[model samples]
Target: MTGSLRGILCVLLSAASPAALRRAFMRRQDEQRKGGPTMWRLRTLASMILLGILGILLATVLIGGILDVRLSRATLDHQYEERARIAASTVADIPEIRTAVLDGDRNRIIQPLAQRLIAGTGASYIVVTDRDGLRFSHPNPQQIGRRLEEPVSVLDGRSHVGIDHGSLGQSANGKAPIVDGRGRVVGQVSVGILENQVAHQLDEEIEAIALYSAIALAAGAAVAMLLTRAVKRVTFGLELREIASLLQEREAMLHGIREGVIGMDAKGRVNLVNDEARRLLGITANAIGQQLDELVPAGRLRRVLAGRDAGADLSVLTDDALLVANHRPVVVGGRPIGSIVTLRDRTELEALIRRMHAVTGLSNALRAQEHEFTNRLHVLVGLLDLGETDEARQYLADLASDQLISAEDLRSRIGPPVVAALVLAKLAVAAESDVDLSVTADSHLDAPAADAQTLMTIIGNLIDNALDAVSAQSGPRRVTLQLRDDDHHVRMVVSDNGPGISAEAVEEIFTDGYSTKSPRGEMRRGMGLALVRRLVYRRNGTIDVSPGPGARFEIRLPLSSLDPVASARTEVSEESR
Candidate 1:
């Protein structure tokens, strides 16, 4: 129903003048970009409502007056016809009139009686006629003893009422028969009231009806005005066109943004969701008006969306995307209304950052190697200049043995080339930071699982976190990593010995956006462990934090089949080779 109304309003608004349309279009765009207040110069809603009400009242008055006039005329005709019948019946029953008519003296006695009756009963005329239709009495004395043109209608001894065109004028007329002592019809009596007299009475009634109608119309107009004021107040005095333009701007803004937007009521029901939100959350448009618990599964995402776990830049891992969300509470008139949450997809950005870090680490290692070689060459040249040939030979032997042993040991211990490279880079970074970072002697692993990216994220974040933890502490900072793989599962343990984690921070450290470190410019903190937890959980793995002298994290993941994309890439690379 609401959609249909909006469509109708759109059609009507489109039919407006072209200049108005252009103005409205420009205003809508400005509001969407800068959120300016609405200004409408068109007809106000109050005026339209007032005009409509007045038109209705006018039409009602005209129709009602016409109907009232017709009904009043009908009533007057019936009433006067009945009055004439009664008068004629009274004259016919008089004994004097009967005797006068019987004696053929109607012309002498009845004419004066008829004149008296015409004055008393308000009739136009009274006529008395014999059985042969010869008029014995009439309003005109000259016509009294003349014969009537028509036959006596009441010769059957019955009373009759109808309209008559007599000598006086058209009138409501009635007739009755006068009987003798033998019960035989002797004569006829007729009475009539003029149509003009009935018309005068109808005019008086019409005046009264019109007065009442005017009073009702005035009352209706007053009520309509009051109602219009109330409606205007409710709408904040916005014209119909302004309201429609705001609606259009709202729709365009909500759908045009790249960030996902969700609006919820105070009761935690979703009231609005933009297209980006629906797509990022893997939900349909039907999610609107549903509770957060219903739209999203029970997890960190649902908790963050419901404002149960409130924070800015909180990271949530959905089924297919990693999202950063910010929650802001909405207030209106100093009362809590609801909240709005904005989401950004960081999956691609995070991947790029990781690759950049890897490249940076490789460059750092090369630089370190070049510096060490240059120092060694300086020593060799000095030894040669001092003529200590035997000492230089022993120094070369020591350097060669040290480099070959370390490289051979790491390659034999870690079978995957990527993992070996990652450890070597971390070792160089650890040396640069004056921290002892090493792999356990018993650590052993086969080639990586097909989902190597997941492994890299988990291993990289854990190792970097351990390094950061120790870098800030004094004295001997040490970090250790152990990896093991079997037919069914892979296991990892990373522990650092610096200022160890406090008991209170054991569970909190894994929460998104909760960091012990100070904030960096524009960069979010404390998302690493949150990402690890989500990935491990998704793969049906278990992770536990043991009581720590330094922080110790242990994880075990069940092995799975190769990733299709990774497998395809490997096949293509092998064919090229």
Candidate 2:
């Protein structure tokens, strides 16, 4: 028992031993990191799984063997018992045996009959006995005429059957009384089968049982090993505890971030929508399992959520917010199985970009002015070198006068210096493009300084687009900019006398990717109008384009109720000038 138990321990330890050693090694290195690398190597997991299969196989074999022995013993006992009973009954009813018992003769009758019956049936013993339980016939000739000392049930003159130990050895036995001619009990007949013979028969049954049990155990273990391998593949050989920890961390990280995140399944249904995503789209938790079309109803955002293509850096405008969004498909094994979308607020970023573009335009205007001044200086020096001092002075005077008149006209018509600077910069841009740029006399504004980018983004894109439209015209390539402000609203108009927009483009002109010019080498085209519409919509403003010989765009935005400090500052700046 001790040796067997030690062997089983060896097998169990063989499976668990490698992982235990690895874990100890990892602990020795724990000071370097919070935890050591995992011990869930392919070999260690295999050993563990094999050990489990071995335990199951051992259990099945042991239980099956025990049951097989008990059942085989029972079957053998019942079979031999019935055989002895039938043989004994046949002998008792024989006519020769009955006559011999009445005549008290064995040599002439019972001896031959007992010998013949034993030969035909292969019973271990067949004997005749008188009423006193004395044997008249026996298979061993030397045992003839001997008195049987053991108790016999047939001696009571009734049939009997049971297991009994006699001179023949332990056997299943049956006894019956032989009758005289008067139908009286005269003597007895006994038949028995040796227990050794029954045991040998049971041995064969056990061997067969062991064979089948071994086959079934091997099949079961093989199935278990295959299943273990499949599990390892699916989990990438990670332990259950490790996998569970990662899942928890993933959930917390996804939900903890401030940016909106949305996850969709292959069928384009919402699978994961974090709190920020829910708030951004104005949907509830019930949005999960809904189609993307149902969650994002707007045109631009819907295209992104539907995963129409691999989207990148898209702009989306909701009811009151502007967002920069990115959408991408989640691919696995070279197949697109899902999608992820991320979003962030872009109001501040757009404002910053607006200011940068305004500064850049102003710098370009200054460079152009510098170049023009250098040319005038060269011409004035030439006039003086030719001894035309009077002509040179008049030229300088004329240049100064023109600069003053332009500045005065801009200062009077535009109240804000930034707006005047933007207009002046655009006029230089128009001059570089060889187009006539004009500001109407009625232009006027008294907006706060903080609203400069808002106005710049709206007017800059329009003016730049208008300049491009008339830059290549054959005849009068002209553009007009008009700005007006009142207590309630601010309005602007940009009209260009270039080749007019076709009626077919009116419906889709403000949509993304809509452009009349063929993009030969440009990185971007047609995004200007879309951005204009998004900015206008976010601020609750209105824009309209009237069809004409050229394009005419008009915009109106609500004037904020000015605070006392801001109103005072505006007046002070105006009074200081």
Candidate 3:
């Protein structure tokens, strides 16, 4: 249960612990079965990344190989064409070959020369033709005297290079014109290399291209594998499906829980804040990725969240809520990561406790009154037994006048019924304790303050502290409470004739969790004066304490109200100014 609770509560990197990741993986596997085999079929994020990179590299290699093959073929053709052109032009420029072709008996001389050049230069064949389109020399000697069936290309006396279908086979062929000394075109020289030879050259280039491409593909695959490993480590070896599932679960758990949860990084940046946290902290804007101090106001709340003020169930007073916060630091792999602070709103619970305290006080007052009534009855019974009727009657008259005189006076002076009841209860308690507790005659309250609860808290805490102060005294004990109300503010004063706060203790009295009193069970002390001070200041009020032979505390809290007439007049006056 502890492990699961920590997993659900903390959103730091620790959330990706091995156990949690395994659970997430199991959940993903179940989801995959439900969704079908195609869902997250790759299983691991690293495998998927590797496969994607390999696929891309494979496609790139294939496309590149095709383009390279095309380019190689074109280059081979150009090379062959250039070779044929050079061979034909060289033979045409020869005075012997040109004279022999023009003489019309060139087979004897040209056939041997063409064969020799073919052996040396690797030309497939060379054909000499006159202007009349008659072949002078051919690789086939039987066709040496035959006129060429095709028209003679030198009729225009220009050289040409292109594919040719000859008796030998299709080849890259170039034709060059042979001219006499008068510069008149007489015949043509054709030189060619077989298509098979060109294809052979192209095949060699394709082999090299394929080898290079394979190497590139291999390098790319290696890189992809290394990249995948890095990503896997970073993601804590969780698959994509697992990560998504964890995120969904985290969101559900974070916002679903009633307690406010805040997750911060080691650097004091807010990484996660749930809906309840936002509502409890009164944070309206997005807080993720923001600095903790920037989002939370500088106070006990911020200090606690930032781990500066550390403790369990540390009470934090916010603008409108009283919160009990517990800060837990999260460490992963023995390294400090960050922390998670859970805030539970204690405002309502604290209010109920205070109300219960009021009821308890009133109950004690009733008990005290009952005890006093019993003693009076005993006196009356004793007087009747002694036969002193006039004395008994007079005693009854005095008891009737004194009975509830303080209650009547309190009701007349205090306006709010709750405050009146609380004070009356305290009065009875003080009387029972043999301490003099009185409300000043000059004290009066017209109505309740706007934030009467805060007002009551301030007054109540002061009075309680005063009673505690007086309770320690050996001699006469007195506690005085004075309340004054006006249109703008409510003032309260509580003083006691007891051992006053020492000069050193007075300075620290209003510090949270700083109590001089002995520990009482599990009850936390020192918050009362601190809380009273906070409430007074929050209401733009002032509190003054006099270190006592007896302690005296005075508080004045401003009343918040809207008067349209006064507001409008003030605005007009400001405009004129």
Tally clashing residue pairs in candidate 1: 0
Against the true structure, candidate 2 reaches a TM-score of 0.53
Encode model 3's per-residue lDDT on 1-577: one tens digit a residue. Answer: 3232233333535333456656865776676677556645655667777898999999999999999999889888888988899899999999989879777863478888888888988898998888887877788988887888888876787888889988899999998999999999988899999999998888889889999999999999998988877665555555665666777767777767898988876677777888899988999988877898788877667888877876678876665566788888877545565787889977666656655765776788788889889999999999999999999999999898775676777888888777787787777778777889889999998654354445556677778778777787688899999999888877898998888888878768887666778754434466688777765664478888888688888888666622223334322211111
- The local lDDT score (0 to 100) that residue 122 gets in candidate 2 is 81
Q: Which wins on TM-score, candidate 1 or candidate 2?
A: 1
Q: Report the number of the highest-TM-score candidate.
A: 3
Candidate 3 C-alpha error for residue 544, in Å: 6.1
lDDT of each: 0.76, 0.71, 0.76
- Candidate 3 wrongly placed segments (more than 4 Å): 1-56, 83-159, 163-171, 175-204, 227-257, 260-278, 282-298, 302-309, 326-343, 361-413, 428-442, 447-454, 465-482, 493-554, 559-577
Q: Which runs in model 2 stand beyond 4 Å of their true positions?
A: 1-43, 80-108, 127-167, 170-191, 239-252, 260-308, 311-577
How far is 161's C-alpha from truth in model 2 (Å)?
6.5
The all-Cα superposition gives candidate 2 an RMSD in Å to the true structure of 11.5
The residue pairs in collision within model 3 are none
Ranking by TM-score: 3, 1, 2
* Clashes per candidate, residues 3 or more apart or on different chains: 0, 0, 0
* Model 1 bad stretches (over 4 Å): 1-57, 68-347, 361-392, 447-449, 497-516, 545-550, 561-577
